[model samples]
Target: MSSYSAPLRDIRFTLFDLLDVESSFARLGFDEAGRDLVDPMLDEAARFAGTVLAPLNKAGDEHGVRYDKDSGSVTTAPGFAEAYRQFTEGGWSGLSAPAEFGGMGLPHVVGMPLEEMINSANLAWGNFPLLSHGAANALQHHGEDWQREVFLGKLVTGEWTGTMCLTEPHCGTDLGLLKTRAEPAADGAYSITGTKIFITAGEHDLTPNIVHLVLARLPDAPAGSKGISLFVVPKFKVGRDGAVGERNAVRCGAVEHKMGIHGSATCVMNFDGAQGWLVGQPHRGLMAMFTMMNTARLGVGLQGLGLAERALQNALRYARERLQSRSLSGPKYPDRPADPIIVQPDVRRMLLTCKALVEGGRALGYHAGLQVDLAAHAGSEEERRQADDLLGFLTPIVKGCLTEWGVECTYHALQCFGGHGYIAEHGMEQLARDARITTLYEGTTGIQALDLMGRKTMQLQGAGLKVFLGMVQAFCEQQAGNAALAEFVGPLAEKAREWQGLTMAIAKRAAGDPEEIGAAAHDYLFYSGYMVLAYWWARSVAAAEASSQPQAFRDAKRETARFYFARILPRTLAHKAAIETGPAPLLALDEAAFDA
Candidate 1:
């Protein structure tokens, strides 16, 4: 059986000691809910995650979800309904929802860590409610007065779940090719008729109704992405009296048989003249969708983080208990036939790499969460704009780099367990399988790369990049003289410089020849990702040095940062070389050359 125990100590350390999360809340005018409230909330969240949700993960995977074609309803795995009941009963679904909509109004800084724990415990179960948050975000951003009043409270309270409907059979990435139709109907509503595929949490029995934030084209809409519009299509139509009325013309055609996260119901949804309300102005659906998409991108990155943490835990537990060969110096456990594998340096390296990435990812995620809060609640407009600009620049990097590192970290963790890791019982293999989608969905790494190189860097004329580099440069300057961090800081500074130079080079090349951007996108994404991680690691080391913690803990932080720069961060060199090479080799290849 797979079990999860939230790393509460680590969570506390990251929030208070490392990042000073309380001070961040204070800065955002949230002092009334200080550490006293924050601490207990986190404790309860961790308890729920470890006790209720974690145990269901393996069972859910084993049982999975079953679809009834006749009834058009999907039955979730055993214990899921009860788990969701407990989850909503505890008000978790409303942790960060707006107060006016029956929520606690907690900021992302507080909500994010809780999200990590829930995801780490059971991603499949966590996903059911996670989508609601995304849907609520979109609605709050672009919804009408009645739309907010009618849907927001129920969504916040988990009375109904939500989903984003963008992908179709023929269109996954390119929305311009989407054929879903949204025609204006009587009574000022739109009639949405389309087939959306890979819709997670699209249809489930856990809630009474599922709200789908769908994208479709109007009858007189222009072609391409500009023609798209967002609509809110509920499974059960609501009457004017705030009661369920008619069963809408929406149904789940089928559910996908996926590689992992089997418990999460991915449905092929069919909309047959479903009644839906327009979210934003016509030809502006992509803009409305981005509100949810950006949040989903970050949420997916955390999925990678959660899976990596699970993989590392399983590997470390096995390494410590499993006896194998003797240690290099001698047999430490002579009583046993051999020695535990953790005594080996290679195993330690693998474990440390996973640890470093997870911890560093936590810092990166928290920083981004803080940015989100600042952007929303900053005292001055200028302060909010700066925070928004910086966060916008890093969002792709956070989503792209963290998820990529997540796969790598999980793979390494699986390797640490040797053959046992491949077995189904250990659950490490499942982590790798589940982590795979993090890179694919919510935008592929290639897409993220293009977004970073083509859109983020070049589109803004390097305004975002300049803001990011300035922050990094300031951090480097502040930490340059720290005796304990000098070694880590120097290399990180160099990597940042290299990253900046590479960004400029790619930008210049992309300006002259647009083809160069495609060729360099992936490499540029990797290079940028490494630089961000390196910078984060260095900042973490500085914080560790300033802490009053035990020497062993501090030493581990410093050592892990060193390992990141030496072993992991150096991969950027290859990526940089590839980026500098531009579109020559990639474009030069003939069409037949790819026939293999």
Candidate 2:
């Protein structure tokens, strides 16, 4: 079996050493976000995650949730409600919320590590509060003044919870195909009637009300995504003055029995002419909905990172404790009948793979979180725009790569445990199962690739790419004098140049043949992800070398970066080759040929 202690040392290294977030926060007008205050919050967050949430992970997976068909009510896994209450009482929901709305008003970067810990401790339990961040994002950017007053504060304070209700049985990624209908009600609220599938935390006992940010087409709506609108539909209706009223028409129809994350209710939500008010402009709901989706996309990336961390920790511990044959070179621990499996080279390969991806990914993910803060709070509009651009560029790569790696890391971690890993008691299998959904739910990896290529690259003309490449160039120049970082700097710079050329190449190809985008998108995204991680891995080595961390820690970072460069980063080469193939290779296989 495995356990999780918050990876505080590495988290701090990422936050302060790599990102220098305290300085960044101060520069962005967060006076109270200094390390003095942030440190204690981190400690408390770790304590709560470890002591409370960690114990519940296995229980949640095993017991899942209890659903009453007659009442259409769902009781979450044991202790889930209590833990959620504690989470709210501890004021964690407001960690990155605006101070004006009853939140602590900390920077999102500050909340990033805390979020990782929560997910690591219990992925299922973490689902309860995760969407609130997105719901709050949608409301903050798009909600009307009265709507904000009526609902936003409660969401920020965790007095209530929130969900994104977008998918129906017929469509998921294609929001334009959704058939949910929203008609005008007498009191100015919309009457929403639809069945939303795969709704996380759709109905639960954790809070008195669940605010659903639903996407539905209006009576006069056009045929596709452009015509959709956003609405705030709550389970228990509330008055304009903020007082809770009678139950609305929204209810849980059924809970899915899934492969993983059983503790969290994945409900089929039925909105039976539910009363909700409009959010943002009509026919602009997709725009507003994306505000929530982009936020959730980043959050989902961390889900993968979080699972990798827990799985790696468990596997590493197993490697050290489990006895196997002596090392091929020689016996390292002669006292035991056999040396620990950790002495074996192949075992080291699996462990190190997890280590390199997990550590480097943490830094990359944390850096993106910092960009979010800068995007919102930077000194100038131009600065904010640049930050947002960089963030957009990184989002798909972060989500796509990290989630795919999360599954990979968990697989390797489980492999390290051998047969025991296959057994449920080892808990590695549960992690592997849980990590599967991250990539699938928040726009599948394929969808993320399309977004990166189609929207971010082609439509925006690689604005985000330009911003990121500029950072890579600036970093390489700044670190030129540091001989210790020279090894990584040279390769990273080479990759950065290659990435720019590769982008131009693909854009040129797609210009001639539109199918080139689809053909190259998946591989191009992986290539970008590998390059991004390479940059972060290089930065991590520099951060470790420059910090006051112990020599062993520094050496470990150096060695892991070496492993990444040698083993993992080269995956880009294969992706690049695939990207250059155009569309002929894929499209040559006609639909009938496969069956024939």
Candidate 3:
């Protein structure tokens, strides 16, 4: 198996150079999270991730997880328990949790790169802590004082893991169709009775207790999404004294046999009259869950960026070592039997695609993380509201675009390995398999696309879009006079205008036929994502050019930025055409005719 290493240089560049975490931390009131502290933490995290977690990845995939039917529990792959022990012992799980709850309380900007490093090293192993962060977000925001005292501390301390129980056999993305029941009980709690499927870290042996944030409906509650309520259901019951007690009615009925992330237990949880405390008010579950959902959505985007970074590293290493046909122009290595594959233009194309995607995606993801910090800690209300709006608008784009690009980058990386890539021993195949789920879960690409086009843009009347568009326009105008950046600035300005025009067109059309929104959703999503990336790529070039960095680094950024504009950004043109094609072609075929 190929060894995995965290790309610390690029990560540092992204954090300190592109996102400017030092300034951000200062502004956000995170005094303790300056570079002096964050750097050492990142170094330790990189060591833990690269040395401890990366080695477990292939072994985890091969061994998978063991389900004990009798105990109704799951055991993870070898070394998982000990690795998780070290992970939590290092206080890594609480990197961004609340300080009052036994956490480090760093900004998301710092935590996000650490997250990328871990996910890159071992995604399957990363899932265990990943879900805990989401659960913490939910509890911190909505949990009652008693509830926080009971559950929040353990979650932040990593003594217990957490899971989000929303999906059932009947429904996945559509939470409105959920049938889980939450009945009132005599103890002022509710009895949750239903089954949740595809629960990550649902039932694992790594922790003593598991906290589940479940969504269920009350008998007298109104129908659909509005009637749902959020509850904190533990695997083992906790007393008012905050001690673990007897097992609750919640149990893992079965573990899923999935294509990837086998080390992470994705289980079918059955809640048969399980005792649970409501986190937020009744019928406001969807709103409460958004706190976690939004966090998870952004985390999912990092998962994509992580996998792509790992894939790029392994592919670049292989490309430089593997001997293949001679270079098209001439043999770059005269002494060797044949030139390395890296000498070939086609191979460079694939490699550069991966490079550009991962780097640009990193900037986008980290920028969003900075927005998260601003939303939480900005000094002024106006700054907080603007940051929150931009974060909301970019969530779906980050989740949808990055995951799909992760898949693309992995495929390219695997192709670089040729026949060897298909084999399990090489580990590229595992990365490919794991990348597939990022898009399907959290929310599928189509779901994110719909959210971006319908709910975020049209429903809100482009409030978020206006904020982002303004940023792009301002940047483009500033760079218009810079001759060194004209190649990028001019096109980016044009694309920004087109993006705004497209939104207006879609809004108008949707007013007459709602299907118009659905029709243009997927296309608009890619179009918006590509445009966002274009802006970032341009900014990266400008940053690199103005920096005191070495000439090679600046050259690489300029070259990659050029490649992105010339090759990938043109993809938006196709998306634009497809959007204009409207819903007619897609909806033309009758049901019987489609089947035929």
Candidate 4:
């Protein structure tokens, strides 16, 4: 059976040591988020994740979700419903939500590690809350006061679940081509008619009711994306008094039989004149939905990080136990029949790659999470703006790079198991399968790359990049005089300069030809991701040197940092070259000529 243990120590290190989250709490004026409360929450979350969710992962994968055509409902894998019960009872659904709305009102930074732990334990099961978090974010930001009172409380308290219904059969990322229609109703609500596909937790048995945040166009609206509007369509009509009423017109047509995350109910939702209330002003849906989508993107990045951590943990265990051919130089474990696979150079490479990527990623992801807390709670308007800018810039990279690396880490992790990894019993293959979707959903890596290089950088004129560069420069300058940090400071400073120079060059090239943006976009994103990660790695090394933690823990951090700089960071060189190459070679091949 597959196994998972929450990396609580590492998580604490990332939050309390590397990021200094205590100061963040003080700055945000979250008086309730003292060490006494945060530590217990983290400890309990880890225990729940390990004991309740991890065991069900394999069973969930094997049994999957059962869809009943006649009933138009879904039954999740066995134990999933009960586990969700415990999850809600624990008040995890509202961990980061407002206290007035029946939530704990914890810092978003604190929620990040809890989320990572839950996802690591069981990603498919984690989908239930992940969707709720996104849905609550949308409603909290754009919903009318009455709507929040009616819907947001339940979503926060885990009494009901939420889903974002956007993708239809005809379109995925392009919201403009959506054919869903919303007609005006005499009751002051709208009648929604649309078939939204690939809705996560769209129709499930986990809750008493499901709240769907849908996107549809009004009858009098203009064409394309500008015409779209947001709506709150509940499975059962919710009265103003919070009473669950009669069934709505919404129904599940079918649940997708996908390659992975099978325990998650990816459903085809049909709203046949379903009653829905408008979320924001008419024809301004995308603007509001972004509040949810952006949050989901960051959560998805954590999903990647969680999966990689699990993969690395399992691989490390197997590598030390499984004996194979003797080491090339000599057997490291002379007492063994041959030697443990950990002695193999390639095995170490794979394991260390996973290590460097995952730990480096943890630091970056948590820092982004901290930025979220800062943006929401910082006192000064300028502080909030800068935090918002940095958070916006890092979102796509965190989502894209971390998910992509999640895939790569799983590949290496499975390889460490050798032929046994492919077998279902070993559970390595399942991780690989589960990780494949992180890149596809919330927005594909390509879409994220475009958002980073095109919208975030080029369109915003690099305002976010300027803020990030300044942070990196400041970190480098702070560590310049410390002899222990000499190895990292010089290299980090150089990468920061190269990063700025690369962005300027891309901007200049795109000025000449806009198509150049798309061409260089993907590479530039990876380059940016590597540079950001490089900074975090260096910072981690500096932190490790100063920390009074056990020597082994500190050594691990330093070794991982050294590996990242020595191995992973050089990847920027290739991306830099590819970005400079521009769109010519990519556009050279004609569509028809290539096929012939």
Candidate 5:
């Protein structure tokens, strides 16, 4: 079993010590429940994850999920239902939900650390309720009054779960090619007919009901994405009195056998003339779906962070206890038969890399959370718009960069475990496998790159990028004289400038050549991701330096920041060079070029 503890020290450092979340909350008009509440909240969440959720993680992976096609029901791994019940009963499901829907109405900053804990404990189990929170977010934002009344409370309480059905066998990213149909019925409802694949939490026995936020086309809808419509199709319809009623027309056709996250039931759902209500405006379903998707994307990024944390914990524990050959300098521990593996430089390097990336990722994720909170609750309209734009710009970076780095971090942590890492018993292999899907799902890394470069960067005519650059510039200017952080801040500022210039160059070249944009998109996004993470590391280093703490904490922050800049941030140079090279070289090769 993998023994995992929440990084409470780091969490406290990030929340109160570094960000002063309490003061930020006060400025935002938060009530008497101030910063003092954060410690207890975090302690309670850590206990739940470490004791309740973490114990079931290995068991869930071993047991996987079984689907009964004849009965059209899904049975999750053992203890999952009970675990979910405990989670909901503890009011965790309502952590960040709106107060109007019976939720705790906490800010995203408050919910972020809890989310990291849950996902680290068990991603598969975490996903079941995670989607529900996301669905509630979409519904609360765009649902009609009746829809909110009917669905929000139960969803917030976890009596109901939710799924987003967008992918089909024929179309996953290209929603314009979707063939699902939604026909209007006489009663102010539509009958949906289609098959949705790769639907997580699509069908499960953990909740009383499952609500699917599906996308389909109207009979007279326009062609492509513009014609898409969103719907709320329930499993086990609700009665007028809010009781569970007849089963809806939607049913799980089959569940997929995936590479990882087996405990999360990925289902093929068949909507056979199922009754569903259109959400938001007609022909504006894509916009409504995005409202949920953007939030879910951020959730996915946290998932990556959580998995990386778990992997690091396992590796760090194993390295300290395992015996290995003597150190190059001498036998450091003469009392033992052999020295511990952690004394080795390469091993330290691996552990340090995980530490740096995970902590840096946490800072970035929390910053994004703060932006989201401000966007929702800021006093001024101008503040709200700026917050919204900042959040929008960082969303893709959070989703893409965190997830991509998550895989690398886990893989390196596994390498730290040596031969045992590849085996199933140590749990490192499972972490790697589970982390793999984070990049592929919730929109692939490639999709995120395209969004960052094309839609987010170019489409806005650089408005979002300019705002982001201004923030970095302001941070650099403010921290210029901090001798302790000069080394970290200066290099990061230079890299940010380099990235900005590269982005402008790409944008210019893309204007003349469409293919250049597509070719350069992935590398450009990565460059942006590295710089963002480096900038986050710089901010964290400065925050840590100001704290009254042990030299070890300050030393660790400075060391990790050094590792990121020296080893990790250099990749941006190559990425920038690739983007500057343009797409002509890539597009010039024909199919016959591979005929060797």
Candidate 6:
């Protein structure tokens, strides 16, 4: 069975050392979120995750959840309910939620590392509380005052759970094509009727109720994406007195037997005149739901990171112990019959790849989390806007690159174990299976690429891109005289210029041929991601050098950063080349000619 330790040191390094999160939080007016308060919480979370949650992970995967066909209810894998009880009792459910809503009111940056630990410990069980974060966020931002007053506190305190019910059988990516109906009902309530597919945490016994943020259309609403509206539908109705009432019209038709995360209930939900309340203005549900979807997208990226981190830990531990053929040069462990695989150059290559990606990815992901706080709590309006813009630019890059890298790193870690990695005994394959869904969910990588290329960069005229480029140029200029960073700063400066020029090149081509954007979108996203990783890797090296950290730690960071720059960053060349090729290669062939 696989095991997990929270990688607490690395997380601390990312937050306190690299990002200076304490000062960042202080400046953002988070008085109680300093290291003195947050450090103990981290320790407690680590203990809970390692001792309680990690032990349940393998069994959770093997046992999965028990779905009662008769009752339309889901019983989570063994120990999941008790763990969630402790999770809520520990106040982890509301770690970053607003204080007035029964939350700890900590900074979002603080919650991110906790998220990483929970997910790494047990991704399936983590799903139990996952959507509550997004649910509370949506309610806090866009829900009616009465709606927030009724629902937000329960969600924050984990007295209940939540879900995002967006997909239908006929619609996955195209929300505009959804046919769920919401009719006018008494007391400003909505009568919702439709079927929603692939609803994560849709129906479970872990909590008293499940809050569903569903998208539907009204009778007079416009056709297509414009008419969509969001609703808060509960499995068991809640009365105005804050008491649980009779069952609503929503029921889980079936639970999907999935490739992975079987402990998570991916349910097919049927809502037959369920009583829901409108969240925001009519015909503007999609806008409100973006509040939830964006939160979910970032959470999914953290899932990828957490899974990869666990996979790497097990692979590294196994590599050092698993004896194999002698090293080509000579056996380092000649005292034994054979050498551990770590001595082999090729094995080292795979490990280094995992290290570079996972560590580099932690930097990128946490920085994005910090940006989330900056966007919300920064001192000045311009600073907040700039931060928000930078965050928008970084979101797709973090989600797309981290998830894709999660898949890549997991496979490499599995490969490091050779055939044993393929077996269920070691738990590597479980991680590989779990990692598969991250890329597919919360918007697929292709969808993220298109979002980045089409909307954020093109329609908005690269506002976020400009903000990020400014950071890159400023960092490069500040470090120009530092000889240790000269290697990275010079190339980084050049890449920043090339990135701007590449954007201009694509814009020019896209203006003439609209298909150019779609053609270049995927490559452009990966290209942007590689460049972004390069920036974080460089900053990591700088942070390592400037810290009073141990020599070994500093050296590891420098070496991994060097490895990233030398080996991985060059992938951008291929992406850039593909982006330059335009639409002909992708669109040239006739649709009917494929089979021929």
How do all models score by TM-score? 0.97, 0.99, 0.99, 0.99, 0.98, 0.99
C-alpha lDDT of all candidate models, in order:
0.86, 0.92, 0.91, 0.91, 0.88, 0.91
- Per-residue lDDT, model 2, residue 68, is 94
Model 2 regions lying over 4 Å from their true place: none
Model 1: runs farther than 4 Å from truth? none
TM for candidate 5 is 0.98
Error of 1 at 60 (Å): 0.8
TM-score, structure 3 vs. true: 0.99
Best by lDDT: 2
Overall local distance difference test of candidate 4: 0.91
Pairwise lDDT winner, candidates 2 and 6: 2
- Report per-prediction Cα RMSD to one decimal: 1.4, 0.9, 1.0, 0.8, 1.4, 0.9
> Candidate 1 on 1-596: residue-level lDDT in tens?
44577777667778888778777788887866687888899889989989888988888888999999997899999999999999899998998787999999887878887888887889888889888888999999999888888999999999999999999999999999999999898788899999999999998989999999999999999999999999999999864346777899999999999998999999999999999989979989999999999888888878877877777777888888889999999999988999999999999888988988888888777787778888999999988988888788778887887788789887998898788778887887777877887888888988998888788888877666787788789988988787867897788778778777777777778779999889988888777777777887888777777877778878888889889888888888898778778789888878888985
Taking the tens digit of each residue's C-alpha lDDT, what string does model 2 give over 1-596? 56999998999888888888888987999998888998888899999999999999999999999999888999998899999989999999999999889998989988898889998999999999999989998999999988888899999999889999999999989999999999998889889999999999999999989999999999999898889999999999877788788999998999999999989999999999989999999989999988999889888999999999999999999999999989998899988999999988889999999999999899889888889999999999999999999999889988998999999999999999999999998899999999999989979999999999999999999999999899899999999988889999999999999999999999998889999999999999999988988888998888888899999999999999999999999999999998888899999999999989
Q: Clash pairs of candidate 2? A: none
Q: Quote model 4's TM-score.
A: 0.99
Per-residue C-alpha lDDT of model 6 across residues 1-596, encoded as one tens digit per residue:
88899998889888888889988888999988888897888899999999999999998899998889899988888899999999999999999998899998888989998999988999988887898899989989999887888999999999999999999999999999999999998777889999999999999888878999999999999999999999999888876556778999999999999999988999999999999988999999998898888888888889999999999999999999999989999889989999999999888999999998898888888889888899999999999999898888888888898999999999999999899999999999999999899999889999999999999999999999999888899999899999999889998889889999999999999989999999999999999988888898888889888998899999999888888889889988999989898999999999999999
Better model by lDDT: candidate 1 vs candidate 4: 4
Runs of candidate 5 exceeding 4 Å displacement: 239-244
Error of 6 at 419 (Å): 0.8
Total clashing pairs in model 2: 0
Cα distance off (Å), candidate 2, residue 513:
0.7
Residue 137's C-alpha lDDT in candidate 1?
91
User: Which regions of candidate 6 fall more than 4 Å away from where they truly are?
Assistant: none
Model 4, 1-596: lDDT tens digits are 56888888888888888888998899899988988898888899999999999999999888899999999989999999999999999888999999989998989988998889888889999998898888898999899999999999999999899999999999999999999999998989889998999999999999989999999999888989999999999999986677778999999999998899878899999999998999989999999899999999999999999999999999999999999989999878888788999989899999999999898899989999999999999999999999999999999999999999999999999999989999998899999999999999999999999999999999998878999999899998888898888888899899889899988998998898999999988998889988988888888877776777789999998888888889889999999999889999999999898978
Candidate 3 — which pairs collide? Answer: none
